[model samples]
Target: MDAFICAGMMIIGRGISRGCIGARTTCLPGWAGVASSRRRNRHRVESSARRPFGKRLERFGVEQGMALIKDEAVVLRRLDFSESSQVLAVFTRAHGQQRVIAKGVKRATRQRASVGIDLLERGDIVFSQRPGGEERLSPLTEWRQLDHYPHLRADLARYYAGLYAGEAVAMLTEAHDPHVGLFDGLRKYLADLSSDEPGLLLARFLWLLLTEIGLQPELSVCTSCRRLVTEDRVLYFSSRSGGAICRDCEPASIEKFQLSVGATKITRGGPTDARGVRAALTMLDYHITEILGRPLRAARSMHATVVKSVSGGG
Candidate 1:
């Protein structure tokens, strides 16, 4: 009894010796039970904290054993990364703009059915991104070519136009936000670039992109006063006002381009000759430059390749 008291192992009132509930007894299981209760409480709090995000993760298509994401993407730019890898900036149909590092795609021995992740190629890509909210580069595991525009690659004019489209899409769209219609429009435009008039096609592409993003100018009316534009007097294409302005609504302080009668008719989807097409292209370019805050690099190249060719041929 003295040894038990010295050991401080005996309960004074809760239990007696020899496992009876009375004074001068020891009980070890009660101590273990208190520790177990603390552990259980801690686990419950942690599990509750994780429940919401876990459900969201499931909604984002994270399966039980898989973390891969799949999407169709158009390659806009490619950069060499080590000896056997390449990093790509692509506009995806499902994920918008994404930067994915394609591992081992640069190696000569890596065989796949795709066009090898070159610039301006549309393909299916499977990738796994990092878990955090910050922008992290993902690993591209598989690539299979879907639409390869060989003609655009072969022609410098068409290639630059396609690059301009890709750049606009990448710059205007937000990451991981799907824009299916825009993706389809770009795919169709690139496909038709080789056979169509390159200058007109590019101008149309810019128009489509601007319209889809809600930035296209008010073509049939005065942007300043919302008046229906008519061929009544000399009109001005106002870059500052974002549309054609009637004579009364034109501001003296703002610089404006004179709208040809033909250009005015073209805005209403009327019959347009070659001159009207040029005028429309010029108006669209000014508006696009206003939105982008700078001239496109490909636009300069296209001036020589597509614009000059159209002018020279006409």
Candidate 2:
């Protein structure tokens, strides 16, 4: 009996010691656990510190009720907002057209002159916007200039053409509606503007923009009667009628422009020459003007400059 009681007491003591150890482990982790937790937290801090600005903002923006966006963009327009700030209309490849205000972008310092953001410059941009405030302007947090297209600045004709392209994008596209093809085409056009014939390049870009936005005018058939248009017949393009109109349909179209065989052929994927390209460009410009209910300002300036250049050469 004495031996059995001693054995029971030993078992009870073991249970009590284990209970205390388990409670301590559960309720209060010791120095090792605390050190391990500290190490994990430090790792997280270092990882976050090494992240890019946009990524860091993305994480913080989620908690702060804002969205962070990063994209390649071209500055279409710029307006001075204050002594040290400016407002811009930028067309981004992924996010479409955005109006953003750049705070303190024009502030002069000892290191650099405050020229501010210029119109028609391409760059990589980082910006932020509120979740429900899309209509309001976004804040442009960071801008790294990619290409200024200095050649365009040197030539009056090229500069006006660039302005025309930028203005068209600003007017035709809706905000926040992405057009990746159009953005790519614009970049290509601007890059080639220094070498390629300005009129031809502009015409191609305009057609691309029109097609991207689903406003391309039909060129193969009579828009009114849906009759197949033969190559030899006279063709008139009517923006209101939505494409090429036959002689019979021409009178009914309130707005019509006569198209030469060469112009029609060029517009229909045929070989292009100087005169044909100009004709096609004029037709497209007319259609765009009708759609916008006003003449494009840059286009008008560009045409005048072209005419003067021609006359002066002559």
Candidate 3:
């Protein structure tokens, strides 16, 4: 009887040991499950945090053949395609100047809502850089509307000035040279000129634009004899070598245009009054016409003429 009881006690202990081992094996998977759930929960929270900017980007998504990119651009000009899409010349803050095509953008519904922006309009844009191509004028994928310079379109003089502005940008900048600051200066100049004084504004604009682009004569000094341009002589402007040559040196280079002594004193980035400005402008216009090889007919017609009051010549 004693032996039987001892054997039973040993068997019961062994069974209890086996049961405990089995219970632990089963609960281990549950522990692993809890750990995995914790890891997944952490991942879920991180993923949730990442969603907004992604949604912002999706709203900003641009379609290319196999990729998408983000960019900010201002509309410089746009051309209508046969009818369905538009080709745009945009100055992207990121990519300088680019010629992009907004595919299927011209339909009445406008897959992209706005038919590329009107000239000189500002906007947020997205476009693709193709797999194989030079960065110059990267193919435009699309233009998302952000803002418009309605004043540029609504007013007549502003429209023409806007065109001249476009000419300035195209002429002065290469396709991919980023000039954010110069453009900001141009934009402010445009906005002021559009609303304030269109007449006097254009002249000042030409002077500013030419000087900014490094096309005008270095008003720093007379190009000829390297003398400080004094305020006393009639000035002759040169388009050939590109600045004023004091009269003494005028005979040497191919003669270009004449500026009154007073005009020479008005340096680049300097001030001028109506009379001084007009004389200076006439000389500047002559230089521009000569250098461009033909007349900027628009500029010619835009001249501020002193009207001989219907009765007689002034």
TM-score winner: 2
Backbone clash numbers for all candidates listed = 2, 0, 3
* Candidate 2 per-residue C-alpha lDDT over 1-314 given as tens digits, one digit per residue, 9 for 90 to 100: 00000111122223222123221121111112212232446565445446553444442222245666889999998999999778999999999999997766676544345677789888878777888788988877567678888889888878888898899999999999999999999999899988866766777788889889999888888999999887689899888888899999899887898986555654555326655666676787888998899988887886765423331222
Considering lDDT, where higher is better, how would the candidates rank from best to worst?
Answer: 2, 1, 3
Q: Which ten residues in a row have the lowest lDDT in candidate 1?
A: 1-10
Q: What's the distance in Å from true for residue 249, model 1?
A: 2.7
Give a tens-digit lDDT track for model 1, residues 232-260.
67788877677788888786628677886
Which is better, 1 or 3, measured by lDDT?
1
In candidate 2, stretches whose alpha carbon ends up further than 4 angstroms from where it belongs are: 1-63, 269-271, 306-314
The TM-score values for the models, in the order shown, are: 0.70, 0.76, 0.65
**Highest-lDDT candidate:** 2
Model 1 / residue 19 / CA error / Å: 72
Provide the lowest-lDDT 10-residue window in model 3. Answer: 1-10
Instruction: Please report the TM-score between candidate 2 and the true structure.
Output: 0.76
TM-score of 3: 0.65
Task: Tell me how many residue pairs clash in candidate 1.
Answer: 2
**Residue 227 of candidate 1: its Cα lDDT?**
82
Please list the C-alpha lDDT of all candidates, in the order they appear: 0.63, 0.71, 0.53
Backbone clashes counted, model 2: 0
